[model samples]
Target: MNRIACALAASFLFASAAHAQDWRNHQERAQDRHEVRQDKRELRDDRRDVAELEAVLANFDRARSRGKEREMVAVESQLRQLLKQELVEGRAELAQDHAEIRRDNREVRSEQWDSRHGGDRRDLRDDRQDRRDDIRDARVEAASQSARKNIARELSSLMGSRRPRDLQRTRTLIIDLIQLARKEVRDTKQEAREDRRELREDRREARDNRW
Candidate 1:
């Protein structure tokens, strides 16, 4: 009876341990899923940051000649913040991926060391490479999709509201026209000056002939 009781207790303890391990695995998986979601959000934000930078560059170019120094300074400040945010987010994502890669490498090393039947070590390496390639592709796809979305948003903005890009273009055309007018006025002034100088010379020659 005692032996049977002891055996039962042992079985109960083993079951409890198994349950605990299963719970831990579940929690780990949940955490991993959460991290992946956060990473994706960060990636999206990073893409937006890049798009904003491009827009800022376009605006900066337009404002450069307009003497809108205060507005330009504010925009530049915002651009710097966005750049920093992007860099920080990128570093975070890279760190997450690097940690994942390190974990995979450790697992592969352990598997290689403990394996009695080695099928193909190269296959494992290839799988790791494939995962890396997939991650890179995902990042690129995210950026591309974000860029398209930005373009759509900008187009909508232009159609729906007064866009700075359009304003800048208009301003540039006006400035160019103004410059051309100034050049024409300056040319006319030079012509008048030359005519005046020739008239004076002709009067001087006539006076000398009379003398």
Candidate 2:
């Protein structure tokens, strides 16, 4: 009877472990799904904001062409308010990009040190990819900062005299910002795609493991 009870206990313990692992995997898959949904929502919001910005740009262009000072003031006010949000967000994003780059550098260095000391080599490729991603993020943030500066400088001039040069400056700034917005949309869409793909792969792996 003692032997039989020991056997039953081991079996119960094994089953409990398996149940816990399965629960953990389910949680991982659910988290991935949540991330995919969040990315999609962000993409939709960005597209909407970009469309609104383009409409405001068009209104500004019309005002500039007509030399309508009052119309220009109204349009510029709208554009400034719209762009203020971007600049604020861009500042925070730039900080995050810098932080990521620093963290990636540290990870890359640690991986190199481990490799030299005969650590697992499988993680090296992933670390390199992370480093590359960090650099790309920094580049995007730099472009956004450039756009922010262009808007600030031109808007300052526009506030002073509404010179033809000030009006001319906005044409270039708005175009650059629009291009950046479109790039963000593309990047966000790709991120969402990758999240979905990862979730699919995880589900498939879990299914295979069960068999």
Candidate 3:
């Protein structure tokens, strides 16, 4: 009887450890979800910024073409000041991205660890897809952050020396950043659709499992 009791206690300890690990995974998944939402919100704001900046640049181009010297001066001055401020903000944003990327990567690694202990993958397609999405989104966000930093760098260079060639390069960077932001927006929207579909499927699966 004592031998049996020892074995039972050992089993109980193993089960409890498994449960705790699963609970930690659950919390990590929740945190990932919250981060994704936050990223979506930031992307929306970036979309707006891209649009407004594009319009402003377009107006500057039009004014330059028409030889509106006075108007061009005003725009350039404003642009210079804006870029100066952007450099500071961009540095902070890059630091934030660095931290977030590390956190995201850690979560992905944790999820991979959890997968080893997960049950019956055949019925968990949604779960698998969600994990894949998490990984993909992290990569996308990392690229987006890098692009933003590059854009800020270009802006900073132009601000320091607004020569014709520098201006052209800044223009190129602006266009590239705009494209990147748009792509991110589209990707996020696609992910959101997948999330909703997966949620519905997950609900159905949960209900079925309850039986």
Candidate 4:
């Protein structure tokens, strides 16, 4: 009877550990999905920025052609400022993305380590990590929305001063920008798809190990 009771308790413990590991894997998969969505949003924003920049460039060209020296100079200044600001923002965002990826990777490694080491303490660590991830995700979403709003406002302001001649030039520029944006969007989507595939494979491997 004593030996039987010990075996039952051991089985229960094993099942509990397996359940915990499964839950951890599910959370990681969800996080990966969130990241893929975030990348898609960023790709859309990038396309918008490209379109706006093209519009501004078109307007500048039109102004120059019309011999409107003052307007040309003003537009040129705006273009320079916009480019500089965009460069700064782009670099900052790239850095943030890299950091987030690194952090996620660390979390994955830690989870694997804990699974190997096996203890209740790992659960507490996971809970803390989840909270941190939630906060970071919220901040990233807010920043993305803010960026989209700013880009829309700038595009609206630039479009407000459009002259009849500017329309044709703007149309041409828009076509070019659209083509470029479409290609970029396609590339981004492909990359995201590949990322998701790898994630799925990792999850499968994790599940196999759990069993």
Number of the top candidate by TM-score? 2
State the lDDT of candidate 1 residue by residue for 164-199, as single tens digits.
676565334333323433332443343334334433
Write candidate 2's Cα lDDT for 72-185 as tens digits.
Answer: 888878878878877786687678668756765765676576567554454455557655865786687688678777767776665535667766777777777787777778
Residue 160 lDDT (model 1): 22
lDDT of 4 by residue, 1-211 (tens): 9999999999998887777667766766776788678778868876776676677767766875796868866765665565456556555655755666565566656566665766445444554554465455445544544554455355445553456555455445444434544554565565566547646754764656555
Q: Work out the TM-score per prediction.
A: 0.42, 0.68, 0.59, 0.53
Better of 3 and 4 by TM-score: 3
Overall lDDT per candidate, in order of appearance: 0.48, 0.71, 0.61, 0.60
Candidate 2: stretches off by over 4 Å? 1-20, 88-150, 153-157
| Model 3: per-residue Cα lDDT over 110-184, one tens digit each | 545555666435434445555666566666666666766677666765744446786677677767755765775
Clashes of 1: 0
RMSD of each: 32.7, 6.5, 5.0, 9.6
Question: For candidate 4, what is the lDDT?
Answer: 0.60
- Predicted model with the maximum lDDT: 2
Error (Å) of candidate 4 at residue 107 is 4.7
Residue pairs in collision within model 4: none
